[model samples]
Target: MVVKSHKIHDVEMVEALKEARQKIFTEIRKVIIGQDQVIEELLISLLARGHCLLIGVPGLAKTLLISTLAKVLRLKFNRIQFTPDLMPSDITGTEIIEDDHSTGKKVFKFVKGPVFANIVLADEINRTPPKTQAALLQAMQEHEVTAAGTTYKLKEPFFVLATQNPIEQEGTYPLPEAQLDRFMFNLWVDYPSEQEEIQIVQYTTSAYSGQPQVVLDAEDITAFQDLVRRVPVATNVVDFAVKLVRMTRPNFDQSPKFVKDWIAWGAGPRASQYLILGAKTRCILDGRPTPEIEDIRAVAKPVLRHRLVTNFNAEAEGVDTIEIIERLLEKV
Candidate 1:
């Protein structure tokens, strides 16, 4: 791990956050039985000022995870249960006519939707149509909402943690790749282990008095995000991340044989950006001052998985993005 040797800014803040990580986990564990990796990735995206898309089947506690995390961070939380009838205005909000107190005249006022909060959980996001789904695109990318030709800035440390059901498709409108690209990390929430499931059942069936305490606020999160951006990475590590992202594109001459054979499309520059951001945050969360090439590789899968489009050969051969990414890691 080659890290540029230098004095990191806000050393005290980084050290405080590093120590607070265990406390945050302890609070989250009160409600969440397991899924440590999922929690870590969510925090990485949060601290990096990026959004995430969680793909998992129902009953995996996806909703609970984000909500619990919001509690742990002490951030304002909102949840929207996306459905077929959900409209774009239901997300970005709508303007209403109201009487003006000063002028005694009817005036239009914009009402903030669930998107105005610090952490918004787009539950069952794919259940909504593309038109409704695209409502979040701007807010996720620009941290602002437009209503009736007026733009309103979202609160600081804003994040949209969206969840999608991978098993159900009958009535679900799949999210387009363009919208998917807005997410920094496409995290997979897997099922709990047997023992963990047993613990979950017992815990839920019993008193279930678990409660998570707050660890940080909006301002604190914003400061840490700034700190993560300031973390130094060796130039070679950055080149490695760029090379890994470039290798995903099958048409590029530099891509490997397997990538060309199986992948029809590749990740764009945003993937590279997220790779570095996520890596830096992960490094800092572990009490390190700098990120390395291995940090880039560690964040590679979540950063690239949703951005990839496999060809027919891949589907026929049953090669998913996970396998493709694993091979890409080895190739890189």
Candidate 2:
């Protein structure tokens, strides 16, 4: 048997890539019982080339979802269990001393850590100290790591799927607003339904163990990303996305009355960028040639939730960011 590589420029290749994504999703469904919405949001973030912050109670299968996605995509996956004692060097690589026996000379060699993988699962991220969490900021934004005065480029399609337990606050260092802004989406995972829970238990206890099937490779994913970027958006759609982000700020004149009283800070330009990119990716996934206002509205919450800040009065009143966002959306 012989295998040949197909050129991406061929029209048939695009169809094949779409088929590959379908198969990838199907394979992921094998191990993952439910949380279809969570899976779709993760896929959008991946296609947008952006990171995600997943917040849910323990035992929601957040880690499993990320691992299953990485498995089907045939990408390298690494899980980092964030802890208070974890150091920045533990996530990023560090310089090590090495000796050249022939010349009897010692030199420093850079040892890469778990961050070198294509998909990184930052589990219980809030448990880690601030300094350790900061190590991921540059990589998530720039797709590269700088160490020992040398910059190393990460592989294409790099994604960081970070998970945090929302109920556990004690002994946990909450992520600062600045670092939270780096994520494109702040997804909230909910518990599975009774039927889904039964299926999960059956799948685990049955003899038919679910195994991930590789449906797409690195090159195919890169091509899909290019296609996602090519998805078109109308002028009004772009303006809607921009206005939606600007209206989140309390200080902005266009902001709603609720926003002015409840929100202490508004989203920045990055939120607008994420909103547009997220809509573009959603359109591509839905097989649409162009983005729509509906697509932007669907993704606005995840993109803007972390960017908006609540005032002390709002906190005292038991008002959350989501409520303020809903009001802004209604007014805008």
Candidate 3:
């Protein structure tokens, strides 16, 4: 009887998840014209409780997409435009001295910054210097920020959706390796197609104004995140993910010659962890019971792209990380 009841619950949860996915897409489509893959990856990262880094040239609607997502999710959203002169205190709140009239004394109060929001969009994150950029590291990893020696827990289901302008790097500071690894997926938001561009122009140039309806709240997001954690993974799937990550390391015995020749540093264990977790999330999001190697393959590029560091020889030879990753995928 208990087993039967559990099975029934699982079915109900799956149905609810499927419905939620459709509802989310419907709401987002009202504002966004296309970029289906980008939307799917963003949803996967959200369900997996992971942060994302969006890379694209300007005017691609990267900021718009993230803001619209926050609206659909009905989370408190904050946008921090990172600048060169921005300080760490700008992102994370600082302490201010306050006068207490009743006690006739002054007390220091910790004022929260934009980082306290449920959905934080760090627009042009690379524009900030390293000191300002590192401000997000603690919040992303620990989910808590320390201000004036007092730790404050952020709201549940916190996410940092950072954007970077790929075409312009003249005055921007490149993110450090340690900080880059914190992101689960480094999604590239490409330009729209010819037809899609026409649609965008028609929609924007017209008097059409549409707002996305709220699809999910904090509780729903928390539940889905927990559900992603509960999703089952097969042994073979886990093995495949591990093997793929291992093959990226040049020093690993299982690594190929291309990795040793073109790659300077390989993905760390976090890549393997994200691969399996992302695969499991992708499986259930597609209404499957268990993850497969194909799911892992689908998430491999985004999960491993930012983690791999290419050598100077590769650049001289016009070789990129994608080529190395594709070769590894073929061999593994």
Candidate 4:
């Protein structure tokens, strides 16, 4: 009887998740035209409770997509524009001296910055210096900020969606490998299709502004994230994910000859972890009870793209990381 009851409950949850997924896409379409893959990946990352780094050229609607999703989430969203002169205090807040008028005494007060919010958009994150960029490291990993030797806890469901302009290398501070590895999915926002581009122009040029409805609150989102973790994976699926990550290392004996020749560095254990988590999230989002090998393959590109480093020979041969990943996917 207990097993039957559990099966019924799981069925209900799966149905509810499917309905919510459709509704979210419906609402997002009002503001965002096309880029269904991008939106789906964003939802997957959120469900996995992982941070995302969006890489694209200017005017690709990366910021707009994030803000639109924020509206639907009904979470406190803070947009921080990273610039050269921006200080760490600008993001993580600082201590300021203030006079306690009642006591006529000066006291130091901690001022929270944009990082205090539930959803933080680090716009043009590469424009800022490494010192200022490093400020986010603690928050992204720890979900809390240490100010004035005092640590303050962040609100639940804290997510950072940082954007980077890939075309412009001038005057931009490249994120170090360690920092880059912190992001679970380094998503690339591509330009819209020709028809989609026309639709975008028609909507933006006119006053046909979209009003997105709030579909899921923080509590509901938190529940979904928990549900993603609860989804089960087969032993073979887990082994496949682990092996795929290990095969990326050029030094690994199991790595292919092409990988050893074209790769400088391979993905770490975190990649394997995210591959499973992302696969679980993807499976649940599709209303599947158990993750399949296809789920892992679907998420491999975004999860491993930034983690793999190609050598100069690959670059000289006009090969990109994504191509190498595709070859790895085919072979592995």
Candidate 5:
């Protein structure tokens, strides 16, 4: 196959970006034994400048994967353990009155919280109340925070990798569809294989210790993100993505019969945009100059999982949103 070359400003820069991405992936694998697909999708989300929601049972190493990726990329990392009683001010900093000794006057200062980091691990996000969860809306959408009538921009290359427990719902507040729409991908982390499980047990039982190496600096990561945006997509591939998203809406005339009955809402335009950007990132990681249709298909589940909303009937029937997505893909 004759792959078309990327229209990067400097051709050599692409080579450097490829090397940096590979090195970071290598370092991440040192600590994370399995779930290579999850890691790759997470990387695609990062490069596409979108947030991710990781859903799985506990002890799947979701936190370890995000933290290790932060370490390998040499980015500031912070973890926020969400709880039902958590308040908005807890995640986004609060204003406190302080007495200035030098000026002899009182002033309100905003103390930064974990949300200001380059990489944030929102552990058990569903445990937090909706009020507290709203604190991340501005940061994820605008890359800025508004507190006490002041807007503070977050650091560049900011990425939120939030994890939620799928099995527990006792004290968990289900994420509102509006908030869930903010995420680019809803990655499902599953248990390891027999061989991988054996390796995990052995590695944990042993006393082996190794620190994560810094494979790429912040500048390089930002550059690669920009490159992902610039990657070219053919008209046909773009149309394919658009059609896939449109078919998810139950109200749409062209939607599949199952989707029309089961889905309450379909994915919006952002889904198509993220789908293209994610495919571009996936292609780059796979050493391809341009994205292919298979790349879009590979990422469809993660990209649309959270975006599509199912009706109560679908839920009562124990049908998943992914099944509706698959039906749409087949029709499209």
Candidate 6:
């Protein structure tokens, strides 16, 4: 009964957010030319309090989109450029000795790093070594950073929006599967259309500037995130999510043949959890009270893409991750 009351209250918030979504899109359009899908997924991930990973090449405005989002949402933003030589301390701050003027003695001080922000853009995350990448694991999962035996809570509404260059692998270290599973969405930022490209060139060649209005603040975002959790979902919708995740595993008894042939390792329980959360957020953004199977379908690709690891058979048959996921979706 208490859950029913929370859902009723959240419905009002969801209704109001319907307009905010349009306002946010309008504000973002000032600077961005296209990639509406990417923006929407990013918002879903942020509002659900989940981390996101974007796979794109250089010059795709991945950085601009995130920075513009931070501006529109009025959140603190930071960017860390990952490189081969980057160290863990660089991403998570290290302890330093300081002279205490009050006591005339030496003291240890922990200067926060770029990770101590509301929105963190981890640029070229794959370029760094595993050790450096591991620094983000705790922060992404726990929303807190532990250094020198002390754990510091990160700011509210915190999320790590990481980007990768898919075209480059010469010096890049692929993210460990453990780290990959931490992200709720693995979005692809494709090349812009011809018309969009022309518009992008036109905008950049001139003094045209786009300043998106501040849509929501930290408090509103935190409340909405709580509301997303409060939204109700049907039992069948939950079952579909769980079943979709299970079918990805090659060893499951009722798994699809293509999955057994192509997939090396399937997604775990986390995938199911994200599917529901993402679906809930999607319906709310569209002003719906509860999610349906179709809502789960819409979020399946991004949620499952990075989770499924293809095997040799998949490679020989020329079946990619997206194709495997699509075929599985067809069966359901």
All models: lDDT? 0.88, 0.85, 0.89, 0.89, 0.85, 0.91
Best by lDDT: 6
16 Cα displacement, candidate 3 (Å): 1.1
Q: Go through the candidates in order and give the clash count of each.
A: 0, 0, 0, 0, 0, 0
Query: What's the C-alpha lDDT at position 68 in model 2?
Result: 88
lDDT of 4 by residue, 150-231 (tens): 9999987989999998888899999988899999999999889999999999999999999999888887777777777778
Please give me the total number of clashing residue pairs in predicted model 1: 0
Question: Which has the higher TM-score value, candidate number 1 or candidate number 3?
Answer: 3
RMSD of each: 3.6, 2.5, 3.0, 3.1, 3.6, 2.9
Local accuracy of candidate 5 as per-residue lDDT tens digits, 108-167: 989988899999888998888777888876688889899988999899899998888888
Q: What's the TM-score of every candidate structure?
A: 0.95, 0.93, 0.96, 0.96, 0.93, 0.97
Clashing pairs in 6: none
- Per-residue CA lDDT of model 3 for 200-280, tens digit only, reads 999999999878998888877877787778888888989999999999998999899999999999999999999988998
Per-residue lDDT value at 230 in model 4: 76
Q: Where is the poorest 10-residue window by lDDT in model 4?
A: 1-10
Positional deviation of residue 186's Cα in model 3 after best superposition, in angstroms: 0.4
- Runs of candidate 2 with Cα error greater than 4 angstroms are 1-18
| Model 2 pairs in collision | none
RMSD of 4: 3.1
Better of 2 and 3 by TM-score: 3
